[model samples]
Structure formats: structure tokens, C-alpha cells
Target: MDKMQRMEQLVEQLNQYNYHYYTLDQPLVSDKEYDLLYDELTALEAETGITLPDSPTGRVGGELLQGFKPHRHLAPLWSLDKAQNEEQLINWNNRVLRLIADYNSKNPDTPLPDPTYVVELKFDGLTLNLTYTDGKLVQASTRGNGVIGEGILAQVKTIKSVPLTIPFTAGTIEVQGEGIMNLSVLAKYNETAAEPLKNARNAAAGALRNLNPRTTAERKLNAYFYNVGYSDGIRFSSHQEMVAFLKENRFKVNPHVTYHDSFQEVIDVLHTIVDKRSSLDYLIDGAVIKITDMRTREVLGYTDKFPRWAVAFKFEAEETTTVLESVTWNVGRTGKITPLARVEPVELAGVTVQNCTLNNVGDIERKNLKFALGTRVFIRRSNDVIPEILGKVTEEQDGGEIVYPVNCPACGFPLEQRGAHLFCNNRLDCKPQIVSRITHFASRDAMDIETFSEKTAEQLHDELNVREPAELYTLTFEQLIKLERFGEKKANNLLKAIEESKGRDLASFLYALGIPNTGKSTTKVLADHFRDLDKIMNATVEELTELPDIGGIVAESIVSFFADPFMQAGIHKMLSLGVEAKPPQQAAPVTDSFFSGKTVVLTGTLHQLGRDEATARLEALGAKVTGSVSKKTDLVIAGEKAGSKLAKAQELGIPVIEDEDELIKLLNGQNE
Candidate 1:
């Protein structure tokens, strides 16, 4: 092949590999192999003076820019309305539905149905508007006030994930996406830096707006396309179609985007994203839910600031800067000495955070944390209820040095240093430790005893001398009534709740036992493997380690916990006091089912069964029910008003069952 042709071929292969590695998480070529091919392309381009616009060589780095020019967006890039909670999200959905209803009322002949929503992750990064002309990248700008923005084409070219050229030659098209710095990239960058970046969002913004493109390239920024601000000679019936078009043109569209017919499903997706936020490689502040139908979005048009058809359901504040007041030590059920930093109350994301976790003495030392009163410290809260200090934000230090406590804050016992963590050995006599253990034992995820707050646990521990979980079952209504905030009715309710907790499942009982490193999921795994408490207690470290997902640390923790005389006595006492731990029921084998080993996606409205019911039924038949329709989907059971998913399934040539009757027949091994 000629030099230009060879470069084009190389670009195509590299782009395909990039898509597989980044988007699909399944790389076809090794990094070393990719690098060798890329180097050859770079050398060929340099020798022949023929550089392909979409070649991977362009992402190496660019010349430093003197200044950024201004670019006006063809169409206004409106912000999304904010929804801090589920109720707010529902209200926004209701308003959009109401608007659609009004439009239907005006035009009765062409009535609009309730619109499906396209939910996407709201990436916490800098927004970039990319404009393409005649299949070539022309302009890239930041979202400056929605109308006009600073041009950053030089810096944008460094993002390897973004396509430098697309296949659209009709006219101009504007695509909006977020430029993000990966958490891993940020950590690597901060290793040798004098002043580290504050957060990923700031790192992205700083990199994108940097005067030096080489610096920006070194940051290794990534982008994910979400919206099309403007398009010419192209038409999309829905947002889903537009996104699919973007993906077809080799844009790095987020794979997490899904189309949901019900608002509850959208909310569920939002919650799921929030729960899995910490596990994600990138930072996302919230989930954006938008009306999928293009016509519906037009009807429920834009307000002054934000689009009426879309809303951002934000999670609790992940990052904020607050003044550090002092540090306090708290004793946990495990007697671990955890440092709690009391900070000046700051509103982050939406919640006010006053106290943040310092984790341990080692963490404080590594972060170079100085608990100087009045100094500003960066606090970050992940999926945890307690926030944690990231680092100091200010230089002015007024407070004294933070001194590690020699003795336990609750009891007079000396703190013992153990592998970067300090622990209090007084597990039996420490008041705070006792209170925490009891409180955790009766927690919702544990024994699930209603009306058993931490304050009530403390009260019971102090007044009634209740030290252990078994003692809780022995408390009488009269004894509870003597305590403060405990009337006759309240006392009766408390006693009844404790009594009702006796039938808690084996997993819950195991978690409630306060075994170190054993969480709810681990407890379930243990319970499923052992089938009973006795089997779990009798299992050796080797056997425990052999269980799925149970490692040496967890296995040793479990075996040691069971071997402890105090723990054994506590379990026996609880069992004697009528705490019946029932083993979880085993699921029936599904190897004989017709739908076994298939992946199914249910979409639209089912008449004969609810969505959850259909999902459960499919799962019971050994079919994995997924939320979105992808190339991996074997079958899609679409019902009435089937929208994006149905269209996608058809486009991908995946088999589809039209109704619940068809699905049921398929499950019965009847060919449709």
C-alpha cells in the first residue's frame, strides 16, 4: 500500500482497538503491540508528509498555545434542572408528563404518550462542545455560560478517546461531552508533583484550559459524548437514536446510558449508580434523566437556565472544603481508634457536613494533615455516611499539632498500635465500644430491631446494664419505661421489636455478631456455603478460605471470631435467649430450563406481568435479565409502546418476543 493508505489502515485498526479497550473493556491487541503499530504509523507520516486527521499519532501531544480564542455555539447548550433527591426527580418527571398531557389535550388527534427517559451519568468534569464539518473536527470549546466558550481545539486533540474525524460529511454537527481525568491518572500525576490537583474535576478543567497542550496531553484526559447540541442534514426521532449515531461515528459515548419507560426505573438506575460510584474509575456527581423522545423534548422546551424535560438527580456531596476545628477519637465495636475531624459545617453537593473521618494516624501522616484549628481542609464523602478529609486546602495554620491519644477516649485503657491502626483492648469494659456493638447488633442491616437507635442503646447500656445482644432480649417493658423518652407505649414497642428480631436470618445474625471484615454480602456468602451457624463455626481456615469471595484475611477473621471464648459465649447466650437463625433457602437448579444461559432484556409495558415479576421469572429460568439492549442480548421481550430498546433490538437483529404470552410460550420451550 501507499504511505497515505498505510496510515489510514493503521488509524482504523488503532481506533477499533481503542474502542475495544476503553468502551468495551475487551482489548484485542496488547499495549506493546499497539505501541509498535502506532510508532510505525508516526514514522511513516513523518517521512511521507501525509498525516491522517483521525490517526492515533495526533494524540501524542500538541504545540503549546499562546492564548485561546472564543467560539460561539451554533445552538444554545442549556443546563439541566437540578433534583437533589428522588422526590425532586419524580416532581420533574411529573412536570414533563403534565406538559406532554397538555400538548395532547391541544392536539387530540395526535396524542403523545408518557415519554420514556434516557438516563445518563452526569460526569464531574469539564464540558466540551465539539463541532465537526464535512467529517472533519473543526472546533472544540468549553461550556462558557452556555452560549459562547473559549476554543480548546489544541488541547482537545490530545484526548485519544475522542475521534479526530468522523464519517458525517453532510453538514456541521455539534456534540457535547465531558473531558475527565481518570482517578488513576490523577494519582500518577500527583506522585511527583509539588502541588497536587484538588480533585478529578478540577484536574480536567485545569488540563483542558491549560496554555500548554503538551501538559494537557501528559494528563491523559478522557471524554464521553452524551448530547448533540446542533445538527444539519440529519434527523433523529429520539435521543437514543442520536446517541447511537454518535457511537456509529466512533465517538466514545457512555455505555451506562439506558432508556427507561418508567420514572421508578430511572430512579432505581440513579440509586444504583450512586451505590456503585466509588467503584467507578471516573467521578460522577449525579445521574441525568432526560426525555428520550425528541418531539416531547420540543414540547416541554427550555426555561431561561435549564431544560424543562431533563433533571440532574445529585448524590450527597462527594467533595467540599471546610475549616478544621479539632480531632476527636471514637471507639468502634472492634475497638479500633478512628480519628474524627470536627470541621466547620459546609454544604456540599446538598448535605451539610460537619464531621469527617481522618481514617487512621497513618492516613493523617501520609496526607500531611495538620489539624490546625481554622485551617481549611478538603473533605470528600464517597458512598459512606461519614465524610473524610482529603487534604489541607489553606496555608494559614493557626491550630496546634494533632496529638494522638495515648489512652482510650472512652476507657482508661492504653491504646495499642497495630499496623497503622490504634486499637483499645478493653472490649468488655469500654462504654463507647459496648454502646457501638449493641447499636450495630440492632441495626437495620443486622438484627433489624425497630426503634433501637444508638441513643437508646446507650441508655440501655448505662441504666439497665445491658452489655450484650442477648441482654437486649431480656429487657422488660417496665425496665424500659424507667428510662428517659420511654413511655408505656414506647417501652412496649421497644420490647416487642427486640422480641420480633429473634427470627432474623442466619446472614443477618452473622453480621450482627460483629465479626471483623464480615459485611452483609460476605455474611450471605458464608451462610449460603455453610447452611447453618454450626457449620460456619466448625469450618477450618482452609475451608473458609475455599469459599467463593472469602480470602485469607476474611477467613482468618471468621475463624478467629468463632474461636474466641467471648464470642462463642455470646452466640450461645443469644441462641439460648430464643434468637433463631434460619439458614437461607437454596435456589433450584435451572440447567433444564429452555432459557438457561441466555441474556434477556425486558422493555416497554407488560400487560400480564410487572417488570420485576418478569425479571424474576426470567432469572428463575436461568436467563440473565439486563437493563439495556446490547449486542450481547439473546432475546428482548418487548411489550406495548416499546421504544428505544425495541428499536435497538431490531437494529441489532436480536430476536424479540412481542408480548407476555410469547415470552411465556418461549419459557415453555415452544418456538415462536
Candidate 2:
């Protein structure tokens, strides 16, 4: 067969397989066989240079777009009003009933009866609006504001569960759904990803907004149609009927939707979902309760931003009250001192939490957090990670106001306040600070020294008198064998890991050094700009500040750190110890770029790029990026969200660019 004919055959076969696997819950072919077919299709498409829009190979990805185009939605996507507790939910139900009663009174001939509710899980993901015409998918967009959205048709086409076409041949139909990455999918991605995704919601949102459709396809995103936003040639009497129609038309609808006659039943469904939340393969922050009767919804109408017929019942945060025992100060890698609260052991989200962070002295003062020994305090486990102290629950005070330490907890050096944080000036002498720095150097995200732990660092510091990172290379395996829990095999492995870390890239080495205000992204920027550690060491503050996202304070911090005699000696010692920091592979610079040599600041949340990604993109286009707005800033890109930097740009009269498309146009010298 010809390449075109083979491609058509492959597309047909693959689409059938996907439909069976994702929609039918059955598979006719093994995973290995499917992969082989997919590979064959990919090769054939490449050979022929012909790709069909509905082809299963589209799930692999497509070319990157310069920017997303604005799409005016056919119908308004209203945000639902939220209820945090049972009382609030009941109040909302009462309002719905009252509105329906008023409507019935007006139309005496056709009196409305009691209203029922349809409760569905509120999936924690990005809202997507899909438009279908003549049973064929035409467009997909995100919920940007309410009336207009960013077009994401290419990314949406890559999702296996989202039907490209349906059996129904109805005229223009718009369906609303959520674009989500399953928790299992996110976990698998995070296993090999350099930067782990925080949660399923963020993973899904990030994938959909990426400029590359291939990234979204690689994420294996899913969508569940819930509501019919607009229909030209179709009609439904109730929400339940609409959901049924969606399912019958081969669209993926949520399975947890239920029709409830009473408010108590809706509450029961919420409880059930909450109980099953840990076991589900997706994340749900709340349950949506909407009037089931279509007539009731029309009568109730909508408020400014939310529909009066629907309310979102948010699940209560996992929190409990515990007794505050005492507070302790801990020193970190950068010699920054943090206050920690030693709370009475309490079980939160199935884990025993004994300690929680109090942030700093400013946080304590802002929260009016006073802790007497044995004082009851509220603690919450947010996002199932760290347990944070909410506030003091009991009024009874047994101890005096908690005091901020004037000296470092480990080295007894005088503490210096830098903004909201307290820092220990003794960078070389503090034991805790040294241990933390060493531990961070060996962390997986930094140098990736396998088997290195905080306890190991502490033991090495206390026993072997290891004062600096270079000293670790001089330690013998025999010496490690002398430490507690260190056997012959373990000591050998640790030594091997230390030896391996010496060959890490310059970015990792820079981050391992624990330079002040230098995170992974900043280290990468520095490495990409300077290429070598020696150049970075000799760079002036002006040169450093000229890089993207590097502000005056961060540049000053970097210069101050590199100029320190102790730091210079330590770096030389490491280099002498066979630590080979490789320079980043170079790329040709972009010439005649409009953004070249311009200082730009991005404020609020950009739909297409995260803060780090935006900084990198702007830097790639030859723009100098900074975090804050200033009179010196040549341009400010303000996004959907509101932030202080946006306000400052207006106050300073700095020219502000709205949305990514406008920025792209400006960069292409197409701005009018």
C-alpha cells in the first residue's frame, strides 16, 4: 500500500483501539501491539508528511504556537457560588426554593413543583469549552474570564477520551467540561520529570496552557463533559437528561453524577465522595449542587458572576486542634534562622504531625500568634503535605509571649534581620547551617548524592570535623565505617555517590554551593549566561543584574557571596579536589529581536507560562527580566490575575502589555 493509504488504515485502527480502551473499558489488542501500530503510524506520517486531524498520532504532539488566539465563547461560563459548610449549603437551597416559589406564583396557570438537585463532583482542573458542529469537533477553548477564552483546539484534540466527532448530527452544540490529568498519570510523570508536579490540578492546567500541543499529548490528559453550555438544534428538559444525552453521544461524562430529591441526600453524596477521595484516581475539591429542573434554572437566573441555581459545597479542610508545647529556632543552609513550633503530637490526614513551621517573627506578629505552654492551637494539613499552625484556639494563657532569638541557635552568632527573615552572619562557623548546606548540596535536586542524609551530614560534621563540601572528598571509606549504621557496603556506596557528584553540570554545582537568593532557575540562568563557574565568580553586579529575573538585591547577594574570601577558598579547594564543573552547551544568540536589550517585568499569572518559564522565554528573546516593577522597566506584561507589581506599573506609568499574544506581537515587531 502507498504511504497515504497506510496512514489512513493506521489512523482508523488506532482510533478504534482508543475508543475501546478509554470509552468501552475493553481492549482488543495488547499494549505492546498497540505501541507497535502507533510507532508504524508515526513513521508513515513522517514519510508522507500528511497528518489527519482525527488521527490517533495527534496525541503525540504538534508544533509550538507563538501564542494562543482569543476565542469568543458562544455562551457565558458562569462561576458557581461556593458554600463552605452544611449551614451555608442549606441557606443556598432555601434561596433556590424561594426563587422558584416566586416564579410559580407569577405563572399561576402552570405552577412549579418542588425542585430536585443534581450533585456532581467538582473536578479540580481547568475549565474547557468544546464546540461541535454537524457531529464534528470544531473548537476548544479555556475559561478565560467568562465571555472570551484562549483557543486550545490543538491540545484538546490530543486527549484520548475527548471525542473528535460524535454520532449526533445536531447543529452547533457547545459542551463544558474539565481538562484533568489523573493522579496516577501525574505520579508516573513526576517519577521521571526533573521538576515534579505539585498536584493533578496543576499538572492538568499546565499541560493545557503549554504552547506546545505535544507536551499536552505527552501528559495523557482526560476530559469529562458535564454541562451543555449552548445548543442550537437540541433541547433538554433537565440536567440529568442532558448528561444522558452526552453519554449516549459517546462523550465522556462523569460517573459520579446523581439526582437527589432532598438536600440531605446531596449532603450524603458529599460525605461519600469525601470518604472515597483518597482512593479516587482524580482530585476533587468540592461537589457541585445544581437545580435539576431546567425550568427552575431559567427562573432562578444568574447573579453577576455566579448562577443562582447552582452552588459549590467545598469540603472542610483537614484540620484539628492540638496543644502548643514550646517553640524552637532552627538554622538553615543560607544561615537564615526560622522559628519552629513543637506541638503536641496530633494525627492529620493519616499522619502524625509533631512539629510545624511558624515562618518567621513577622508571621507570628501578623497572625497575633501567642503560645503559652499547653495552649490549644489549631493545626491544618494543607494539600496533605506540611501541617501548619492556624491559630490559637484556647484563650487560657500559661506562658509569656514567645520571644525571637537574638543569637543563632547553633553558632551563637548575632542574628541580622533582612526584611521578614532573620539571618545568622556567621556563614562559616554555624554548625546547623553547615550541616544544612551540606545536606542541600547532596539533595536529589542539587548534586544528587545518593544515600546522603541530614543525619549523615551532622555525624560527619561532629565526628570527622568536615567543615566544607571539599572536605567530603578527602574522607576515607575506613573512616565512614567507624560511624554508626555505616557498614562496609554502605560506606563504599556513599563514597561512589560523592565521587559521581563531582562531575555534575555547572547549574547543579552552582545550586549545591547554596549561594544566597540563587534557586534552581536562577542558577540555570547564571550558568546559561556565563557558561562557566570562573566567569560567574568574576562577574560584576551590573553584569549579574543584566540577566533575566535577576534583580538588584539578588545580584548584590550573588556578588557579595562570590567576593567572600572564605567562599573563594572553599570553591578553589573543591576544584582542586577533582570537581569538574562543565559549562553549558551554547546556542546561537537571537539577532535583531525586538525584545533585545529591553528590561521587562511580568506581573500576575500568565495563562501560557509559569513565572520561571516566562523568565526563560523572555531571556531567550534577549530581554532582561526582573521580578519587580520599577521606573527603569521598559515593559510590563500583566496577565489575568491581579498583583502588586501590576498596580506599581500603572503608578509608575510604565507601558503595560496585556496577555501573551500582545507580547508576542511586540516581540515580532508587529505591534500597532
Highest-scoring model, lDDT: 1
Candidate 1 RMSD computed on C-alpha atoms after optimal superposition onto the true structure: 9.4
Candidate 1 TM-score, true structure as reference = 0.60
Off by over 4 Å in 1: 1-14, 24-124, 131-161, 169-174, 181-197, 210-222, 226-244, 253-322, 345-369, 377-400, 416-421, 442-505, 532-672
Q: How accurate is candidate 1 locally (lDDT)?
A: 0.83
The root-mean-square deviation over C-alpha atoms between each candidate and the true structure, in angstroms, is: 9.4, 21.0
The sequence of per-residue lDDT tens digits that candidate 2 reaches over residues 330-390 is 8888888888899889877668889987777766654446545567777766444467675
Give model 2's clash tally.
2
lDDT of 2: 0.81
* Residue 496 CA displacement from its true place in model 2, Å: 50
